[model samples]
Target: MHPHSPDESPAPRPAGSPRSIDPRRLRADDLRYLLAVSRTGRLVTAADALGVDHTTVSRRVAALEKSIGLRLIERGPDGWTLTEIGRAISDSARVIEEAIDRVVDTVEGQDSLSLHGTVRVSAPDGFGTAFATPALVRVRRHHPQLQVELITATRQLALRPSGFDLAVVIGVPAGSRLVTEHLTDYTLGLYACDDYLAKYGRPKSLAELREHPLIFYIESMLQVGDLDIERHLPGMTPAFSSTNVFAQLEATQQGAGIGVLPAFLTQRTQLRRLLPDEIDIRLPITLAVRREAVTHAAVRALWAALRQEVAERADELLLE
Candidate 1:
């Protein structure tokens, strides 16, 4: 006789198989999977929403039914529907989910004001250097135990739960996994050093702007297309280009060329605004973080500090 195959010890159960079950054996995963199915009414959709495969969702639902000792779902060619028992249990699952979220919020809230743990923040080079760094200095002074690592780059930082605790963004982020809050709107104006204007002759009109050398963002390295200041002055090109805003600012300060800079930078510097009356540009600022990271105390503390810092310094950030 052929040897029995170990894998054939028992055949896999088909959908809605009749079998004995123990309700007390169910776990939180079982309930959550059931809730997903209840909300979506299809295994494929539920799997997609929960970031799992349809097979996993089917197995989870089957396991939940087996543990509850009842068939809570009616599966058909069209879709799945919760039976009366399934609906009742799904309602309970929602309550359980809410309760769990509340528990997490309470724990996180209790420690929201905590002065511990490291928070990693990502922001644009200009904002990070000219604004975020100084604000963080005050945040650090208040929370001696808390540490901050500010990552600055010209391109948008890839947002991930493991990457950064928070990000200050100039444009709307692409992914759905991140939650965003409007931080503030700020203005930018064309500026040049007194020496540069004296040498190059200040342009009194938009049409005269091209006569002067311009310092602007490097086109190849530009991430946000709206940041191309030359867009406002058609046919204009930069005499000097850099990926870093601070570099452009310095170049402008050294009388290399006129550069469009944030109001906050210009207000702090002795740079003279060129055609200030004609050039009016406004950009929105947003604070973003992974939805999963919102419950962390360190993230919350940093978020509050960033908001407060922006609000307190609105005069410096926004144009008059």
Candidate 2:
């Protein structure tokens, strides 16, 4: 995500001019560009949302910073992030957006598609396809004009997040700007297919598991600290490592090795669960978004839909 920076810092106040910091100098129209940049993390994307160009987005935000006498944003490697004061300013800017929406609602009439525009979301592959998809579908059905983009990847939430409006992560993320909540707790277990066990011999105990080949995520590429193999199975390692959970499942199904996989994923498979009591691993799913995002109608709708989906289908997320 390339968030444009017209300058490393806000345009410096005119040298010793009588122009004091004044709220009246701030243009109400410019805040929309700042709000769009805050949500999209890229000048181009913000431009698309605002029906303007990237240069215009940069110029407007710079003007906002100058008027407010504070740096509204700083460029990070991934994108631009709001400064502490910038976030505070963003909070007020969100109120303006809400007021504008209210005005539009009064004029256009509150149609079902009043909540339009793209809401980008990110999640792990398995959960994105399984749990999140249902919620996304439900939201789309209600607001047919709303566009939801879900990018599936297993990684730590960014301290300075970009490229997505919302994210569902494996565990709680540590970020001052993020507002997070517990989504659900899901369980994982050691499992082997009938053919796999017949070929490699079933592990009767925890000690026996160490001697067999393990199927799980590749150590080097696995970024989610919660899925660390050593945390759950010390001294044991994956013989067949894969980035994709489905690949690990398939390898186990094809008699490759015992797999430490989510129970929800293996529920319909013929794989045999092993040492349910000793090897049961439970982890939490978390929902996160920047504080400024709460004002967005589409984002709020998607958030409610996801929470409702998880609560209603709680049975599907866990084995026992």
Candidate 3:
């Protein structure tokens, strides 16, 4: 984060002498330091973010501008602002910084446990809303500077550069470039409201489940085909279908029909698990990150936090 700066600017190329721009003058450390200053707009704040002194940040910026032969930034009473050329250069530098960081992570494993900056996570809507969100909140409490972005979607997300920093998925990833690990296994069982059971009667066995209507996922919209509960129960059909688990859960609660629900999501509701002994369905949850991010400090910390939290709450998550 910190790079030595020269107090004096380098002597300008002699007038009319061919001014050669040596690419070597633009160092990765210098670019990263400038990128930090550009983001924070203040030397002290940028220094704090990079864990360096303000003077080091200022000197590095000055040195970068000198070596590049362009004024990359301007500082005044209004705070720091990048020049027209500075903006373009800084933007390019940011990309290089990211690539360099990834390379560094690839070479040296996770180096720090201190979580900072932002980590974007993608997960299934149900788990992201009911489970991962709360767990990430706890992680934020431990590292106040860490920011977590949880994107919940019905479809499986891609694990690659420009995608989510981390993904918690229900099944396996398609590509080999992603680093995936089994997080935990959760249980899903047939559940229905007490009112519904009283009115329609609970199924006594898997074979009897056909007598009652089913509330389940829409076949065409299912992100993971295995989640189509009726596939596990032969000759069964859905009387009510939805792509959203929450909607299906709500309908099931209103005495609509029996629905397969994650056990943790139903714990606080009045729904009763039906034929638990016969209909215990387990789904393995996997945590995936781009291979390049396996050694990233912030990503590693976030991954560790999620794994620890999920494991600690296995009873609630896995229905043990």
TM per candidate: 0.63, 0.85, 0.65
In model 3, the runs with Cα more than 4 Å from the true position are: 1-114, 159-162
- By TM-score, the candidates rank as 2, 3, 1
Top-TM-score candidate index: 2
Give the alpha carbon lDDT tens digit for every residue of 1-320 in model 3.
Answer: 22333454544667887667888877678887776655555677677767999888878877887787767776544356566676567657755755665566566664334455656678888888877787788888876657677878766643222335678888766665568899888888889998988888878987789888888888767878557665577767789998788998999999999997888888888988899888888888888885545655667777887887787778987774
Q: Candidate 2 vs candidate 3: which has greater lDDT?
A: 2
Residue pairs clashing in model 1 are: none
In angstroms, how far off is 188's CA in candidate 2? Answer: 0.6
For all candidates in order, the CA lDDT equals 0.72, 0.83, 0.74
Residue 160, model 2, lDDT: 76
Quote the lDDT for 53 in model 2.
84
For candidate 2, the TM-score is 0.85
Error of 3 at 220 (Å): 0.3
- Candidates 1 and 3, the one with greater lDDT: 3
- Among all windows of 10 consecutive residues in model 2, the one with the lowest summed lDDT is 1-10
- By summed lDDT, the worst window of 10 consecutive residues in model 1 runs over 1-10
Q: What lDDT is obtained when candidate 1 is compared to the true structure?
A: 0.72
lDDT of 3: 0.74
lDDT per residue as tens, model 1, 240-298 = 99888888889989988889788888777889877877887888888888554566555
